[model samples]
Target: MSAFDEFAAVHETHIGVVFLVGERAYKLKKPVNLEFVDFSTPQRRLAACRREVELNRRLSPDVYLGVSEVSDVDGGPADYLVVMRRMPEDRRLSTLVKEGEDVSEVVDRLARMIAAFHSTAARGEEISAEGGRDAIRQRWCDSFDQVRQVGVLDGDLTAEIERLTLDFLAGREPMFRRRIAAGRVLDGHGDLLTDDVFCLDDGPRVLDCLEFDDRLRWLDGLDDIAFLAMDLERLGATESARRLLDRYAEFAADPAPASLRHHYIAYRAFVRAKVACLRATQGDAASRRTAREYADLALRHLRAGRPRLIMVGGLPGTGKSTVAGLVADELGAVLLSTDRLRKELAGRSPRESAAAEYQRGIYAPEHTERTYGELLRRASELLAEGETVVLDASWIRADDRTEAERTAARAHSEVVALRCVAPAEVAAQRMRERHGDVSDADPRIAAAMSRDVDSWPSASDIDTSGTPARSLAQALRVLVD
Candidate 1:
């Protein structure tokens, strides 16, 4: 075919081989015995090949065509193969995230798809029992043991991770029990990193559902998505990950606790490190370095970083939220939007029309004061818990900026103010072009804010009239460093 053999390319994963022949691909299960799975025999590998097509079809129905038996060994009925269509490399979600393509819309659709998948996924006594408190603890503890036995990670870091995981799981037994009783456990897509997902025009086609072991596939739906979430965090797509979790929780009506989120993120990071170590043992040089990197990521997840308060402020349409979103994602900090908070507080739809004049109606000074106070309250709470936070608001008044500084002082955190500035003409144009935004700043309000804007000499000013990506990179250099 095309001056070559039928198979044009070969790929090797930890437990499988893939042969890419033109637009079609065939996967062959590796005959090996790992700690979590056994595919040592041809019969077992064949069954796993069938299971791979069967389980992954639930997520990527169009991509996973079917199973095939291909004979390339000793001219006999030999190795089993999974035949499917191959997508372009650029369409992968991981690639899009790395390339900084705007995939916010795709992430929304992804959350919906995952939520729907979990709703229809299998859940019963058998599955729920496997997702019980003890079972979940055992799974994390086993991960710790495995990573430790691998002898690749730092000893003190491992001890600290084990300590944190054990303490969190032990303290949250009741929550796990409640989740199990609620029948929220399911046979989910167990390995949900970005590499296995494709963001096609239709939507995301998720593949690789960890089919070798059924026990590994059974999990709490939250735990299932956390793998992708953790991967997103590591990829510096933190805001997208946050939005995905929030949308999924809102859609599923199954909000996970902050502690549970931390636990699972650490677990997923450790698991990533373990997988990288496996690749390293097989003489993959890049994976050898990646193993340590993932281990360091796990260590960061297991421990709390120094708390800081990031202030993103600007007149309307200077792209405060855009820069703050990037800063929050890079730091994995909590993002609080004043516009969303105001809409929430006013008990009004974000799209509802508001014809308020300057400091009139719900935009009155009293309401403004209350919103700022509540925002600071929330920031203080998160900071007190040793989590960094980013507040997206217009710090027009010097008094309000002082209040934020005082709040950070009380919480024992430093305040970093990033004032986004665009020329008056640019800001005016942006306001006129704004659509479908949560912010209620019309051109009139933006003009009013611009006229009344006060200068903050101490604040670092970032010109945001240029390209958003380059502007954000500049802001991150200041905010993160």
Candidate 2:
């Protein structure tokens, strides 16, 4: 413990030890097995220390001094270490964000820096296989499984995250295949968060590339930047995060969808959440709170990705509104129901029943069109403010769905339609059980609507005749997938 008086400050991680001396820093690999990496022997530690110095020099060239030895004065080999010139703590990217300094210019520069690195990063068959479609899926499953099996977070939250992630991986097969085929995967800094960066006067020097395992650093370039963006947002620099993405896209001429950005951000957020929970298990009380906070942040990222418009529709009494409400709560979305909006438009309460016959009186053809138009109008407004919206109605007409698509296009958002269906008997039973809810559709009305509600192959289908839990799960899969 009394190694040197020049460096009294020291920090120990699971696999490495760092000592901050005057104007210098020394890092030593722990003689232990981390399951991910092993430094249990002198020769292994020497190799790892050399690798750390070499990998980190790519980003922090000036900071990494060289390798050193922990041998006795008698020329006996004891251990190995990586040496570095210490950087000013105040110049760290995280410190600047904490001080509320304007770092927009540097943040932009950081994006370009990463873009250049990713453009020239090594990519071969072996590297691609490490980040291949199946490997990436397993990586996600393994990460969430770590958190899931440990029972660190809430059970409901764990279940929700698992369902959403599983759906994204299962349904977005083409997205992953295209990226892999395009050679978007590369060896990158596995941990590129803000804290690992220094905003020097020359530029930004990113430090601490994942040195434990080379496979861990093999990644999709977008995923690499995503971890940084997520960290920037976590530090309350949301505008900086947005700027980084915008600048990176311009620099790289990327054509990936807005959905992919959201996907990566959500994935990064969850990864950080898992990290925080792991820290809590190591007996960090503050980290326990941070774990929950990160979990919520991940949910938000998963919810609204570029202001999508989700259309939930079917014949009346098929549980469209019920399922829509469940989705809204899951995504923290703005749900617009025709039954509620129609009453509001008529200067009546949402709970009030308008005893009009099907396709007659206030329920006439023109009224239906106007009601849908207003719903679309409101959805556009919310989307403009960066809000996801759910439209609940019996969209039995082909023109109705087309109109919704047009509205989403004009608002620069994508449309996902979820068509609910149930047997005639189940539909009639649900209608009979309804009392003071918003919708006023009766069993007879449902029969009338079902006659016209032809199948639309474009929309995802959700059979709602099962238990509510099963129906809600199906609805979530449709929305995410």
Candidate 3:
């Protein structure tokens, strides 16, 4: 069952082998049933070849020629092959990136092309189900089991990554539902590695999608794009990887949070790591190292995407609320203010006048404890579901700060304590000028609070005596550094 006497080159992967002859490439499915794919029979292989061509033509129409039947000497069909126009070996996106080429324009065009493709890709109830939180959790659990079974990666690290990934998914059910409602789930190119993308003179030709499993192909658009973004970062093109996501978000008008982007990227990396583990099991020694590298990348992205509890506290009129709002905007975190939560918990409006002396009436020790307790309770719930939170309150008591720390610890989150400060006169003036705000503190109350304020050595002091922008900058630096 041979047409060509000699092949120019042969490239072999776990699933199939490609024979390059002249200007055409022929792909033959290996007669083996793997965990993720099946090509163990002639009939199945033929169907797979046909599916590959039909699905791939959506992106690379000119390159995918058609499925060909390889016959025996009796002219009876013996095997099947995916025949196509061979792309230039030197023109792959991976090759160009390795050569340090300035591929900014090419990356931009590719992002737009993928965005346009996703804009029209299939989307319905069935496909949207694949983008749900449960679907994502299943895939992650599958990868974890496979990786653990292989016994190649470090067990402790694997567990940590697994916990972080699940925690991220736990808090994002609403976000995932929003994506489904907005039609972000689609049947897309599931295998979007850079090596499969050919950067040609005309534009780019993206090929070699996961054709064996339709379930795998049905995913959120962000998950589809993340495969390539993960590959790009692995290739050391971190900036290009970032730009691609940014441009794609702009083109698609995707209102995804940064945490979601990082989470998806981490998921892609873990999937590749799973593949590498499989390769290692097949006796590919170098794949073992690759598996570790991918696992590490996955861990890095997960940590970057983990939820945080940012505590912005100081005496009243030191601009704690203002700084907390800015930090929340910067990190896309939920902002919780004592003033707002206290009012909501009680039977009062946020702007209703509740002017009272410090630690009295609505601001009593018992009532204040309830407000902070409620804030921590709400924050713990959000953090459990992978949401970052910034709490704005006068953290004058060490007991309250300790409680916040304990809450963060329970959620496996980092706590950033920021103590906002201003000149005494500035604070007094701000309190004096307070009008329709939720805060009931006046200059006299501010002075009383300052005297009662406990020592807070752990928190970074953000001086609010200057402009709001300056205070925000200081707080952000503390968060970053």
Q: Rate the local accuracy (lDDT) of all candidates.
A: 0.81, 0.82, 0.90
Runs off by more than 4 Å, candidate 2: 1-8, 306-481
lDDT string, candidate 3, 1-481, tens digits = 1434444789897789999997899999999998778889999999999999999999999999999999899999999999999888878899999999988988899899999999999888999999999999998999999999999999999999999998777656777887899999999999999999998889999998888999888999988998899999999999999999999999999867678889999999999899899899999999999999999999999988978999999888899999999999988899999999888888899999877777778888889989999999999877765678999998888999999999988776789999998888888888888789988888878778778788998999999999999999999888878
- The numbered model that scores best in TM-score is 3
TM-score of each: 0.61, 0.66, 0.82
Give me the overall lDDT of model 1. 0.81
Per-residue lDDT over 216-316 for candidate 2, one digit per residue giving the tens place of the 0 to 100 score: 88988888898899989999999999899889888877766555677688888888888888888888879877888888777776655646789998887
Evaluate residue 253 in candidate 1 and report its C-alpha lDDT on the 0 to 100 scale.
88
Order of quality (TM-score): 3, 2, 1
Better of 2 and 3 by TM-score: 3
Stretches of candidate 1 exceeding 4 Å from the true structure: 1-7, 71-76, 280-288, 304-481
* Model 1 TM-score on a 0 to 1 scale: 0.61
Q: Write the per-residue lDDT of candidate 1 for residues 1-481, one digit (tens) a residue.
A: 4433454788897788888888898998888998768999989988888888889989888898988877765878777888898877678899999999888998889889999999999988888888887997787777777767777667887787777666555444556777888778999998998988888888899988888778888998888888888898889998988787888888788855554566667778888888887777777789867877877776676554346789999988888989989888877789998887877788978767665898888788898888899999999877655467899999888888899999887765678999998898888788788777777787789878777777787788888989988878888777656
